[model samples]
Target: MELQNRREFGKKMLGTTLNYFLLESLFTSQAFASSVRPVATHWAKQLTEICNDLKLQKIPPVLWQQQVEKLFNQIELPELLKFIDFETLTRGFDYPDLGVNTRMVKFPKLDGLPEKTVFIRKIFGMKKGRAIIPHGHSNMSSAHLVLKGEFALKHYDKVAEEDKYLLIKPTIEKTAGVGSSSSVSDEKNNIHWFIANTETAFTFDVIMVDLGGKAYDIHNIDIAAGEKAGNGLIRAAKLDVETALKKYGKQHH
Candidate 1:
């Protein structure tokens, strides 16, 4: 009987140790995931699909987000937690252009829209005529929400492609109607470029929706001399709201 009691105690101790180990492992995994960036490919593919659908079908962004939220909510918590929170990433970059004099705060998740991937980004002390370099998404598209000042966006298309040089030209396609949102097959207007203009250093929000799974998609092309007409341009487009404001300010002031 004494031996039986000892065996029972041993079993209980073993169980307790196992429970502790499991809890520790869970905590460690959560910590690891929180620190890691989301895999770019997974998020970029989905986001690209969304952009194409919106541009082609003329579907509203809000409605698209709703559908995405539903799909993402079904993802396991471990996978869902992999994203870098906007507030967190903002703190890492130092922006003097947007007059971001204060620390950034992650926009709180709206109660019903738990799956919407939204962020409120700020660039402090920004001004007009500043240069925004060319870049492209290996997988995403972004929208600038003018929270504070005005911004100008110039979309460029690759006019020519060459092994030695990259040639590009600017084009503006007014995205006013529904069909504008649905057409994604031809994204010639969605190429490489930059942004800049004149405005007071201020802050604005950029809603960077993922195209596949990456943070930013930058495609930098090299426009070399003697390149054939068919291949003379490199394209990298950027959207900075502050640049738009600068243009507006110049016109009014």
Candidate 2:
């Protein structure tokens, strides 16, 4: 009986010690990670943290929008752009001028930053009277922050999906200037249209399409051609890239 008691005590001590070590290790790792990627007005890092949390499914997509809006509201556009090396990049960068859509540019992540691969970061530039077009996606979420000029931004909540159309209802319509922003998720504010209202407009974006490990789909909605649905909704047809740009990009109003 004495030997049995001793064995039980030893087992209990071992379990306690293991738990203590495990907790210590966890705290240590968290601290190390925090040091490696401090998030003090480092706009990119904060965005990455959210992207990581998002891809891990720790936070729902709808909540991702709130966090992104908060971040954009907190940071200045020039500061954010400098961190991402935007001026250096566009100094000599060139692209074919588009009459209807944005020019998407992918810049390298700042060196020494911790890796966060769940999302793709990009800058979309547009001429006045051009747009980002109206589009909805599956298994994706994105945030767009106006960095250069103004845009007439519109958002829609996808009500239903059919073989050829996405039934959606308008959710937000407003003029967005520098530091203004919008975000999209699969279930909320799913379709977004951005028409540049300035001579030149730029938006820095973080897009994650590989949610749930399933293939993502981009459905460009032809808003004007959408069939009227009851209850202030519209069944918009999906369009090809060329068609979408030509059709919706030049529509300023």
Candidate 3:
């Protein structure tokens, strides 16, 4: 009877110890997740402030680019994703079999904010071999941050104008992935394209525009059909939104 009691006590103690460890682990993980919330909150506040200031100050495009890059460089990929509530922001669209699809992160509607204030954020989800069709912004500025996977980005300087086409001079071409960021403005490397180099990829963009100014237009270009215009410049053919979307919509399944 004494041996039976001892065995029962031993089993009870082992079970208690196991339960205690499991609870401890669960609490630790929750605590860790909570600890990162503040960091994410800080980033959200900072971005809001920057966008607000841009609206009031209308800072030069170069300065705007520099400020945005500085802020983005401070955070690494893991930290960026940790605080971001992807489930809340994401609309959960069906991923296209090929090419890229954009999902806009819905910003909470704020009281007293103007109806036309241009503050936009979006995620570009891309499948491998698909590309973000070449396009340029009009009277706007944007920052692109690679949140996941890999992409090959090419930028071109809209140097001069030919009769109906923009004479674009190749600026820089490079591969970018998590932690990589780039910016575009009305001036500078405004014309750009990104090709997904991984099985799946995502890019986060914060875009600000002057709604009262001109309706921002994405001037699309066809690189394959571009003609050399000397001095390393190429005259790219302009493509309407519908044509551009149809042609570069899909590359592979």
Clashing pairs in 2: none
Best lDDT goes to which candidate? 2
Clashes of 1: 64
Give the runs in model 2 whose Cα sits over 4 Å from its true position.
Answer: 1-42, 93-112
Tens digits of per-residue lDDT for model 2, 168-248: 999999999988889999979999998888888888888888798888989998898888889999999989988887777
Tell me the tens digit of each residue's lDDT in model 1 across 8-83.
9999999999999999988866665444424334443454455556545455544554444443433333343234
Per-model TM-score on C-alpha atoms:
0.37, 0.77, 0.75
Error of 1 at 103 (Å): 7.7
Candidate closer to the true structure by TM-score (higher is better), 1 or 3: 3
lDDT of 3 by residue, 204-251 (tens): 888988633667766888876899988898998888867776777556
Q: What C-alpha lDDT does candidate 1 achieve relative to the native structure?
A: 0.40
Per-residue lDDT, model 3, residue 113, is: 32
The lowest-lDDT stretch of 10 consecutive residues in candidate 3 is 107-116
Off by over 4 Å in 3: 1-37, 87-93, 106-118, 161-163
What C-alpha lDDT, on a 0 to 100 scale, does residue 205 get in candidate 1? Answer: 26
Best by TM-score: 2
